[model samples]
Target chain A: MQQVFGNKKAIAVFVLPTLILFIVVGFLPIVQSVYYSLLEWDGFGKGKFVGFALYQDLFVNDTYGIKFLNSVWNTFYLAILSVCVQLPFAFFLAHVLARGIKGEKFYRTFFFIPVTISSAVIGLLFLSVLNPNYGVLNIVLDQLGLGSWKHDWLTEDKTALSSIFLPAVWQWVGYYMLLMYAAIKGISEDLFEAAKIDGASGWRMTFSIVIPLIAPIIKVCVIFAVIGSLKFFDLTFIMTNGAPQPATDVPSTLMYNAIFRRNMYGYGSVMAVFMVLECLLVYFALQRLFRSREEEVAR
Target chain B: MISALRTKWSNVVLQFFLIAFAVVQLYPLVWLVLTSFKTNLEITGSNVIGLPSKWMFENYKYVWVGSDLARNFANSLWYTAITVVASGLLASMVSYAVTRMKWKLSKLVLLIIMSGLMIPVHATLLPLFIILRDVHLLNTPWALIVPYTVNAIPTAMFILVGFFSALPRELEEASVVDGCSIYQVFFRIMLPLVKPALVSISIFTFLSAWNELMFANTFINKSSLMTITVAINSLRGLHTTEYGPIAAGMVIATLPTILMYIFLSDKVQKSIVAGAIKG
Candidate 1:
């Protein structure tokens, strides 16, 4: 068995299919995108090579009227909300629920339901609920005498991007909660017992013991949230499709519009390449940031 | 005495808060189901939260027959089934080779596969579209299936690697000493050992493929070839004022996932947690 398994041919036979598929369907596209980004083509009948002009136009010049910089900034705004607001709220719920509360299974299942369903479904659900005239949100607000606060959530430029975050947070809070909850649950009971015997209060135990121990998982959740937000397209696509003049445009949706709608394939590939690089850079930067903080804590 | 009393009061308050949050989390789904049963007049009327005075079960029938939902549902089912099986088998095989077999480039191979996780779908969309168009696979189910399987390889391999590595080596050694071929050892002996992991990863893969929208939206242009996600999205444009049919469409699109959660919630939750920490 060792001889057969260790044979070079056997290894190639086992691994080559996956590797080749990954390269073709997964890796090759990005390489092709990078290559395409350098050329000037409209996705068909193209043979011109104008190197770096597309990238220059994307950043310095607004020749294409793509709003590329604004889309990047919008993506950053969503990523910040994901890390700052979404994950913390998820962490709070996880910390509370990890206390071995009753109906744990029920609550966990319910919380995660949104995570499992299609984002388009969630987007439509909220779109209907937040509709200005007969939507439930405005109706509820009117009954509570806060009708003045109600606005057209997904249409108006000011509220469209922020309004989408409500559904985004609603969709993913359970996901991060489950992650943190699992990490917290892995902490041994003996530590809590030891702290209790040492007369540590509940808040102290949470602050000094639980939070510190789950710091690594917290970092993982943050990375997930940030990366997920940066590439977010489905909900916004369903809700607004970057309507009302690109107010809710993220890089992914913008890339889609450039490629499919406007037939600007080269420009779209530029956005795609930017997104790939941004994800990698953000991931590495986060790893470094988390590692430095861990070292400081150790010191 | 005062502290204990305070603890009890706080627990009550905490429970109230959690329940309220849960209500907020679940109310939209409940409203969706209720609205699916309401008339268009009821939905757009002033009575927002009231129960339907007369149930409109025909909303479901109309949406089902009026759109390509039934065909899209079949497409989604087959696409997910093929993707889960193909990706699972291929990932497990690679993971098995890397972990159990002797190979010098195993670590490099693993790293390459793992890096696939960071490549966003947006980055690959145009090139893939061009390739599929060139291959005449655009507007075909193969377009979705190929990408789905390829993209799922990393996560499936990530999960399977842990399970494959943790299996005791003694069993493999004994199987070898008994004159079993590598294939026999893998197929007859090792495959059954990782059944639980396979099931968990399959569930994850199924859910991902089921909920996927972008690729389905881009690759398959024909209404008949559309997936449930794209089909439901088209409903938004088709029946803008008809909330009842739209709600019914959502319920249809969401039912499979809801059922999976009901039956396999624990496995699903555990696998998700494991994948997150391990990945």
Candidate 2:
């Protein structure tokens, strides 16, 4: 059995193909992007080495820097809102649903529908809903005697970025809810029974029991939300394409414009490198944050 | 008796809250479907959110024929189908080897594959674009299929590894004792046992490939090669006033997944829960 299982050729056949593909597509590009970020290439001509010059531009050059920072802020804003706003709402929904309400399964399943559909479809759907003239939103606002509230949601800079976030947040509320819901559901019922027998109410049980128990999952959810926001592109790309350019841009839309649209391969690669490092940084930071806290709880 | 009455009243309130939020979650989709069949005039005029006076089934006809939507739909289907198969096969092989095989480097290999999940898709776009271009895969089906399959592999491996790890060692040992070759053991014995994992992984791989837009938009410039998401986005730009057909396009793009979910919600839900727990 050990001989068969350890057959070198069989192991090679099984692992080599996947390993090669993963490295070429999944792993190599990241290394390539880091190398490319240091060059000044238009993706056609010979690349000139300019170590950290583009990075300087990304950080301080007025035109590019301002736009890059704004996009970063926009993404971070979404991250903040996702963690602060969306997760809580999802947790509330999860908490209520986990309490075994009527139609609990139905609600759990239905809420996740937005997540399954493509962001492009959701973006287009919201575009129609937020269209200033014929949009359902403005029309509804008019009917509600709030006509003054109507603005060009996709066009106006003040409203554009936030408008994009609505659909972005809306789509994933169910997702994080489901994650937390599953975690909450996994808690042994005996604990809940004991708490109830001690005369704890639902809210008290949630705070003292559910919240503490599912804290790790909630932390995971936060990392997901933040990382998701950091990389979010499809909806913003679909809805605005950074219409109020620089205002509505996220790092991804900017990276896209730099590479595909403008042929600034080097510049774009810098943005790409920045994003990858940023994601890694945040991921490690969060893991460290969560791990320390878990140790504290254990202590 | 009074406390029981209060509990009943609170349960009603909770039910009401859940129902209300459900409407919020589902109404936009329902509205999109309704708007799909409505005349553009009605959509922009007297019936923004109500039933259309004239249900224009022709809208579907227009989007399907007047553009490359049918071709795009075919491309999306072709890409998604190939991706699902390729990722599932590759992932299963990797999972089986890492879990069952007694190899020294299996741990390192699994770690390498799993780390693929951490790199955001956009982070790799520039280099991937260059790589594809250099290989002359740009504007071809391989451009999207290769990337989509590669992207899905890590998650597919993550899911399949658990299933593969849980299987008893005796099954493989018995198969080997019966004179089955390693390939035979994997193909005949191991593959059939993990069919449920394959199904869940396929559902996930299918959804990502089907809904993918950035790569589809960037890589494929030829109208014939574009996928449904790009086609729908283009329709919105080209036929701005023709809301009916655009809505129809959105519906067509969305219908497969919605219908799929309705049929396989249990598997879909489990797959998602499983995927998220990996983090």
Give the per-residue lDDT of model 2 (tens digit) for B1-279. Answer: 999999999998888888888898999999999999998778988788898788899999999999999999998999999999999999999899999999899999999999998989898888888889898999999999999999999999999999999999999999899999999999999999999999999998888899999999989989899999999999877898899999999999998899899999989988888876676
**TM-score per model over all chains:** 0.98, 0.98
DockQ of each: 0.81, 0.83
- Model 1 misplaced regions, further than 4 Å: none
Candidate 2: regions farther than 4 A off: A63-66
lDDT of each: 0.89, 0.91
Residue-wise C-alpha lDDT for candidate 1, range B1-279, written one tens digit per residue: 999999889889988988999999999899999999999888987456888888899999989998888888888999999999999889988999999999899999999999887889889999999999999999999999999999888988888999999999999999889988887788899889999989988988998999998999999989999999999888878777778988999999999988998898998998788678753
User: Candidate 2 chain A: minimum summed lDDT over ten consecutive residues — where?
Assistant: A58-67
What are the RMSD figures for all models against the true structure?
A: 1.2, 1.2
Candidate 2 docking category?
high
Clashing pairs in 2: none
DockQ of structure 1: 0.81
TM-score of chain A of each: 0.97, 0.97
